[model samples]
Target: MPMRGLTILVATGDAERLHTALGFAAATAATGARIRLHLHEGAVALLAAPLSAPNDPARHKAGLPKLGELWEEALGLGVAISLCQSGLALHDLDLEKLDPRLEAQGPVSVMTGLGDDRLVAF
Candidate 1:
């Protein structure tokens, strides 16, 4: 049987890592595999509204999609993107400013929801 789904844990603040994670999520989701991308720690910033992609110009100039575009594509492809609740608190980010598409959840909730999905961490 084919793989059931994929769970990606993104906990870094690095732009390249975030870009890659979203890229994988979008691509995997396009292949019809269920995808859940959980953002914790510094990665939570990606969900903030008016999303910033520091490497966007360079990536765009290099003929690649911008990071924000990749994120939108992932959402369009049915990737479930979530943010860690404690990560918001730890970073002092205003929850109200986050992307509404994201499901705010705790670690336990995320873990319990991962039913046999392959896990990948970045």
Candidate 2:
């Protein structure tokens, strides 16, 4: 019952990093740890709706997840997907029009609020 908490800060991700982070976080839950995912920069597109990215031929042949699929999966697992204020604002993403999940994205203050020791910035 000693489950731990983990906060994953994703500043940016393309095809590769997205796949890895999703898998890594899902696997961590098996070790009895919680997860929080912070999104910023270009990474915000992963959850921009329809929850999918372009197919990687190699990964597709192996039935790996696409961008959107990976995000939906992580959400289903209860990882807190937070957005960065400055990052989104810089990108001109309207906070009011964003998905409900985007609201979880907050200022640096929220990051400081995590009590867990696990913090990964990618």
Candidate 3:
């Protein structure tokens, strides 16, 4: 049977992992599946205003999309992205300064919101 939906939880600060997660989200969303991505722990930094990806240069040189570009594509494909509020506080990041596209939510809400969706962690 096909997946009902997809929920991706990103808890690492690694840029490459974040890139991969967003890529999956974009691809799944393209198939008209409901996609929700939750950024928790150190991964919240990926949505910070000055989005930085140390490895994006190499990916760009290889004719691949940058991290930020992938993120935008995921959002454009109707993926719902959320950033954990506690994670933002842990990083001392102001929610207002992060990407406005992100919905600030608690971990519990992110988890409980998943209804029969396949959960994937990165």
Candidate 4:
């Protein structure tokens, strides 16, 4: 049987949460599973092209990669990334501020469009 695709919903803005979600994507993709990362609420911040300040001291701890490095790894693994339309607006972030590779998707489409894909939340 073919490996299943995964749809990950990331709604938190915290760096640790983002790290966890992206790390999961990396590990899953390494196993040949398709990955779709949906960014909503504060999670959309992860896709910002400009690097955020290195404020999270814990990010430098052993073994864990920085948020930007995780993002690049996910992209390199060909993970399909989407940003929530309303979620972006609510966060007061202009669509252009995000990485151009990320598609803008509405809630209805995000929920219903995922077919037989496993859903994970962060």
Candidate 5:
């Protein structure tokens, strides 16, 4: 089988979606796949330091780990993390205040850099 590359484009700020998307990135990376996580739209809020995890017990019972933990795992696994600059401006967020681990770039730069990777948007 061909090695598959995964690119996750996150566009929502919903805690549940962020949790799920982080899960995907960590899981994919665990399988030795190349992974890239791009935060856009409202999802850019997650790039802030000290991210919040979902508080619902059901999410935990369903086997989803804390979003912050999953994010750390993903980054440790070498998943490239990026945030949209326009998204930050749209939401009135300062780029300097975002997590230093995330690279700030335009959407076109991210998309063009993906090459042949499979893209999954959340």
Candidate 6:
């Protein structure tokens, strides 16, 4: 039987791009699809703590929900989230910032683990 799986690349620095990528991955995994999400570049911020320096509530609230919310939703639906080691170092973040279910891998290693299926980049 053919395996149904997806590995999405989230390497953009744009907030919207990162959020959209996660949304797509979450949606796919919601339907019992096996999924892998790779976070790189500024996209690593998606797995970080909510902003504390302060910003416009309108911008933040509307642009995307807090990372915690997104993370929870993905975990609830059994999606696997991960980080790019290089990207994490560049952004000064660590595995503590990621959900326990998520992994920290090097470059495109996560995609390689997916074993030939759909691959989307945002």
Q: Using TM-score as the measure, name the better of candidate 3 and candidate 5.
A: 3
What TM value does model 5 have? Answer: 0.82
Q: What would the per-residue lDDT of candidate 6 be over residues 50-122, giving only the tens digit for each residue?
A: 6222323554668865544565787788877777888788878877755578778876576558676688888
Candidate 6 has its poorest 10 consecutive residues by lDDT at: 50-59
For lDDT, the strongest prediction is: 3
Model 2 segments more than 4 A misplaced: 30-32, 45-55, 104-107
Compose the digit string of candidate 2's lDDT tens values, residues 23-81: 77777765667777777767765545455445656666899866666667777777667
Stretches of model 1 off by over 4 angstroms after superposition: 48-50
Clash count per candidate: 0, 3, 0, 0, 0, 0
Q: How far is 12's C-alpha from truth in model 2 (Å)?
A: 2.2
Model-by-model lDDT, in order? 0.82, 0.67, 0.86, 0.77, 0.80, 0.71
Supply candidate 6's per-residue lDDT for 68: 48
- Give the per-residue lDDT digits (tens) of candidate 1, residues 10-47: 98766678788989898889888889999887888655
Model 4 clash number? 0
Residue pair clashes in candidate 5: none
List the pairs of residues colliding in candidate 3: none
The ten-residue window of minimal lDDT in model 5 covers 47-56
Point out the higher-scoring one by TM-score: 1 or 2.
Answer: 1
What ordering of candidates by lDDT runs from best to worst? 3, 1, 5, 4, 6, 2
> Is candidate 1 or 4 superior in lDDT?
1
Q: What is the C-alpha RMSD of each candidate to the true structure, in Å?
A: 1.9, 2.7, 1.7, 2.6, 2.4, 3.9
| Count of backbone collisions within predicted model 1 | 0
Evaluate residue 55 in candidate 1 and report its C-alpha lDDT on the 0 to 100 scale.
Answer: 83
Per-prediction TM-score to the true structure, in the order listed = 0.87, 0.77, 0.89, 0.82, 0.82, 0.75
> Quick one: how many clashes does candidate 3 have?
0
Q: Give me candidate 6's TM-score against the actual structure.
A: 0.75
